[model samples]
Target: MLILGCMVLIAGCGCLGLWFAYRIRRRPQELRECSMALALLDTEIVWGATPLPEAFGILKERTDVPWQGFFGELKERLSQGESAGIAWKETMIAQNSHFCLKSEDWNVIGDVGKGLGRSDRTEQHKQIELVQRQLMVIKEQAETWSGKQAKMWSYLGFLGGIAGVLILI
Candidate 1:
């Protein structure tokens, strides 16, 4: 029973490490998806001449999770009479913990919120493009870090679990 308990504990710790690794690996993908979602928003707003709420509603339908949820929340907030910037900030604040994105990424996103519905279509397009560029750079950095650190985290987790088991024994 003692050995069994130790084994289970080690396995659980190892799984926790794997979860961390997975999160790291997912960060770059999430950033890239965010950039793409911004491009979609740009299209909806600039080319299609859609209103902020309607554009966000379109984004909510077309994007993936986190983004899908983000856009949906933004749409709902826009309906509640909040400005785009405030709604965006609140949404980011509320959902920040659930995402793998860092503060800088959120800042980049915040820029978009600040610009939304504040300027003409051309200016909005420029702001969205700037954000997309920033996100691409951040995504590249995240990819590099993920490639190196993801494996490290997984290994460290497993080793830490082994160390804990040894200490317990």
Candidate 2:
């Protein structure tokens, strides 16, 4: 009876381990897709063109990732330009979406922010403050994503260990 109990436990653990492994295998693809999306956003910003609204819409539709108001303001600024009658700074503060940083657009915003203080005063510098704010948001979101992934991996490891112990018994 004791041996049977041990066998059962071992099977349970093995099942858990397999579940974790599957999750782990799937995560990289998600991350890769996310990274590629962000790269596309970066390309658009580098060219000084407005990002596709569809991209933002898709990101918003797909992920629960967090973002800041500043990104929206940046987008609006690019879309409306100086004549749009909206205060870029204020709009940045008002715009908030978890969807923003999940896409590649955040990185492009960061690059644009770095050039703000320079004498060249390119379009990149026009929204420097907004970009800086967004970069911070992106950094935070990346950390959060990493932490979650790590936790998932750790859980998988624990389950695997339990399975091994059960087998030994």
**Residue range with the least summed lDDT across 10 consecutive positions in model 1:** 96-105
Q: For model 2, how big is the CA root-mean-square deviation?
A: 9.7
Cα lDDT of model 1 by residue, 49-106, tens digit: 9999999999999888888888899999999999998999999998888799888889
Q: Any runs in candidate 2 off by more than 4 Å, and if so which?
A: 1-7, 51-55, 61-169
Tens-digit per-residue lDDT, 34-146, candidate 2: 44434444444445454334334443444333332333444455455432223333433344242322336434433443442233424543454355455555555655665
Error of 1 at 130 (Å): 0.4
Query: Which TM-score value belongs to model 1?
Result: 0.97
Evaluated with lDDT, which candidate comes out highest? Answer: 1
Native-structure RMSD, model 1: 0.9
Q: Which residue pairs in candidate 1 collide?
A: none
Model-by-model lDDT, in order? Answer: 0.91, 0.46
